[model samples]
Target: MSLSVARRTVTTPILLGLLLVAFALLALVVGSKPFNQTIIDIFLKVIFVVGLWVFIGNSGVISFGHTAFACLGGYIAAWTTIKPMLKGTAMPGLPDWLMGMEIPFWASAVLAAGWAALWALIFGAVLMRLSGIAASIATFAMLAMVNSIYSNWESVTAATSSVVGIPIVRSIWPYLIAALIAVFAAWAYGISRHGLALRAARDEPTAAAASGIDIPRARLIAFVISGAIMGMGGALYAHSIGIVTPDTFYLGLAFITLSMLVVGGMGSLSGAVLGVLILSSLIQILRWLEAGIEIGTTTFALPGGVQEIALGAVMILILMFRPAGIMGNRDLSLPRGAASDSQGQTGPKT
Candidate 1:
């Protein structure tokens, strides 16, 4: 790479790191709840949004069913930390092997993500084979399928009611570490040749195939990787909530995740993180506005839907003005000639 591109690769991450630290500290300080818990929540959100960017943002394949992966992760992870004898507290059916098979927090987490990735492999194969509206339709269908399974599969997760006593413990430190790993994983992938090929395939499938790239393989790989990451995020969220239900994943969460990616800049990792922070804060502000706060001389009176309305307006405005996203496919602003020597020049400039 040239000096300028090289500099950006080095310095841009440093700046992002600083920003993460700043935001994390801010998260740690917010609300009356323990700072650690709040920080953990934000960090998990970071993981979810950033992980989604790996596929949805880069490959330009919008998925509306990622919540399935999240739900799978949460349910499986619940099995690890939850003591089976808790009876109704654990998932029903309780296969004899799982009835007493409670593992450590992290181990269960790994298994949960593995299961999610396996599902992604199967579903992503079919979905990745499609394009544009067809692919989107398949993904939406996947979400519906996953939702039905989660809701009706009582044998495993306690039916439609609560899956209780998950024994989830949330803290700032673990999530902070997870967030760092997630960001680095996304950055490394984006900077690699495989990612380059995927992006190429996304922009022009016929040309990419003519150039010997296996478009399906690239999309599948990206899909699996992204699903696994989202699973990890779900595990974290499950542990945070201590208990959950299938309904948890179906309440507009998929839309929220997609919106975050769109608002943040579907083209770049920073945009993913930025979009989450901006939108999450917006929600908090709206909540505070709707519930009049005691501020010395004034009380704010905002409508209840202010948060939703504001987010919707912002999303519309962003899409209308810069459809590519805030970063517009630029990972980071390059300094002069950073990429002096780069591969895949034949690929369209992103």
Candidate 2:
């Protein structure tokens, strides 16, 4: 690659990483435990949304099942981090070796990624065969199936009950590091040959297939990579709160992450990061309002559920005005616009 092209290649991730670092510094300056936690939440959302972007942005496939991978990862954290005696009491059906295994939070996160990736490969092998709405439906079905199994497998999963005693990681640095890793990973994959082929298959399916690109194979690669990222995010999420439950990684998380992707621009990696940051900030503001702010003598507060309502309204407004999302398929690049390294485009058609 030419020097300018190489410069462009690294610029996007560097910009995104700097943004995350800025947030971490802001949280440190604020020093409020609540604000720090909110920043951590934003980092986790960044990880999840970016993970979604790796596959959906490149392949143009909307997946409702990615959170199921998160669910798997969350349980992995619960199984591996909790004390052995606690695991035996809460999940008697765990294999003896698994029940006895106790690892650190970081180790559990690594294991979670591998576990989630394995399932992604298994599901993607079949699901990637379908396209359009058929594939979307298949993914949703996969989510539902996973949810059902986890909800009922009482011995292994504790069924619908919450599993507690996870090692809570209150530090912001870990989350910041994980989010940066996620950003770089997505940026790297977007420029890879597989990513290029997947986008080709997405934009010109018949032509790409005619040229000998295996669309399913390319998509499956993205699926597994994305699944691994989501898994690690899920594991970190559990550590963030010191608990895990089947419902925690279900539809709510799936929708919120997807909304971030859509609102930021589905085709741009920069959009994914911006979506989470923007919406998460708005949510925090609404939450503060709900908790009531004291202004001189009187206290003002919005309704309890205004955050959710506001989020829905904001999404509607963005969709109406900026149908392509806030970024609109553009990466956040340096001033020189001639060399744009957007994940949405793989340079001019040769």
Q: Which residue segments of model 2 deviate by more than 4 Å?
A: 1-6, 337-339
TM-score attained by model 1:
0.90
Over 155-190, each residue of candidate 1 has an lDDT whose tens digit, in order, gives 787768787777767556667777777777776666
Q: Which candidate should be chosen as best, given lDDT against the real structure?
A: 2
In model 2, what lDDT does residue 200 have?
90
| lDDT of residue 15 for candidate 1 | 54
Question: Candidate 2 lDDT, tens digit per residue, 134-195?
Answer: 99889999999999999999999999998998999999999999999999999888887788
Query: Which stretches of candidate 1 lie above 4 Å from their native place?
Result: 1-13, 27-31, 34-36, 87-90, 333-350
